[model samples]
Target: MNKLQVEAIEHGTVIDHIPAGMGVRILKFFQLTTNGERITVGLNLRSGENGTKDLIKVENTTFTKEQADQLALFASSATINQIANFEVISKYHVELPEAIDEVLACPNSNCITNHQPAKTRFYVKQSDQAPKLKCQYCEKSFNVELFSELN
Candidate 1:
């Protein structure tokens, strides 16, 4: 091992097992573009199990269930851990819901979730073997592959 990896944070949330290309997307979801917190992002890491992985370590950021659920939609196999004093206080395996909310704004022009004043929510429909979704409020369905964070 190169031992180039950074040291762990004293306290915060760690998102591990993100898919190779989705770490930055998740970071954007958390609005982690720039901040004073000691956020560490490591991608294409070696995973004993998966052979490759990605990780996000956010220092002092209290992740809400809603936020976690958003990432879970893509990183369903990810692991969320609460750390304190460089020790894991607790751990959670992200379980993407059958429906996701606010994490996305439906691209369908007529979908109710697309209204600026509306709360964007969608039914996950499927998360494995070809992810898909359907709007909870407007009954619109689309490919999760089409839902992406704006740059």
Candidate 2:
């Protein structure tokens, strides 16, 4: 029998344990739009003789807290593996923050976050609390913001 092998990278972040369908969404959410050769993603891969899983390899890529937080929200179960010299160096666990920016859109009709050329803002809100966001411009409730796109 013949066997094929793949070499591990010297350094990079490998995201594993992503829920079945969430792998693709994570790639797009980060806007991996540049078509960079450094990024790699494998979906529905067999895992340790068990069920299928997903994996993402970002070559020489180190994520900021914000980026990791964003990933957590989408796939809380995902595990981050730091690889160096083709071996696991560190294992990172993902945690979802209470809020995520540029992710959700304000539901308010007059919310500036929804207008052209505006950067979206996400905030933690309470059921009894008044407006959510302190508008940078209009100083009104941008509180209605909700996740605009699931992907």
Candidate 3:
């Protein structure tokens, strides 16, 4: 059988293991379209571990810790691969922080953080299957899906 391959990048980041169909969301989260970075997205690709997964390659860009953490809200299983000079320099799984500030918007409209200039803060509740978040200001509990509603 023949195999397909994505062109490798010289220097940038490769995000692998994203949940299938989430490549566009990741791109939106990073605001890559407006920035003019060369981006390639593969969706619903075969994965031995996940059955199906998505991948994103951003040329000439590296993700920051905060950005990676934000990505975890949606693509928890994603891994970051740093490439330099056509070589894999580093690779690591994205880790969600115990608490994230301003990375997510509180879904509750009455929450103080949403009404004012205050940054939204959340205390992450860990889980093996799915994580939940509790708003620090309103004491509201929500799932990561709220990320799609972020302002």
Candidate 4:
């Protein structure tokens, strides 16, 4: 089988090994639109370890620590590569933070974080299949799907 290759970005960040079909979710997490930056996405790409994966290249854009940490909710095994002048300058894996505040909203409507003027805080529970989040305000445990309902 022939493999399609995505053009190498001159400078920016390449996120590889994303969970298959989750590229769009990552883009949404970043709130990135196609109009502003040069972005490339490859979905369901073959991987040696993982059966298939997704790849995203953002030209002239680099992710912040908070952004990278947020990505760990989905793309835990993903690698971020810094490319400069078409050469990789650095490579690192996304690390999930112990806690994230205000990034994700608690799904419980009656939760204090949702009703009051307080930022939602979550204690991240790491797992290979999915990240489990416990709302600090309501003590409600939910999965990544609930986390996507960020406010």
Taking all chains together, each candidate's TM-score versus the true structure is 0.80, 0.66, 0.83, 0.84
Residue-level lDDT tens digits of model 4 in 1-53: 54655789899989998989889988886665544888899989889865999
Best by TM-score: 4
Off by over 4 Å in 2: 1-7, 33-35, 48-50, 102-110, 116-119, 124-151
lDDT of 3 by residue, 30-77 (tens): 666666889888889888964998899899998887777767877889
TM-score between candidate 1 and the true structure: 0.80
TM-score of 3: 0.83
lDDT of 4 at 55: 93
lDDT of 4: 0.83
Candidate lDDT scores, in order, read: 0.76, 0.64, 0.82, 0.83
What's the distance in Å from true for residue 48, model 1? 0.7
lDDT of 1 by residue, 24-109 (tens): 87776556756678789998987786577889999987677666766776688899888888889888888777666665777787
Best by lDDT: 4
Worst 10 residues of 3 by lDDT: 142-151
Q: Worst lDDT window (10 residues) for model 2?
A: 142-151
lDDT, candidate 4, residue 59? 91
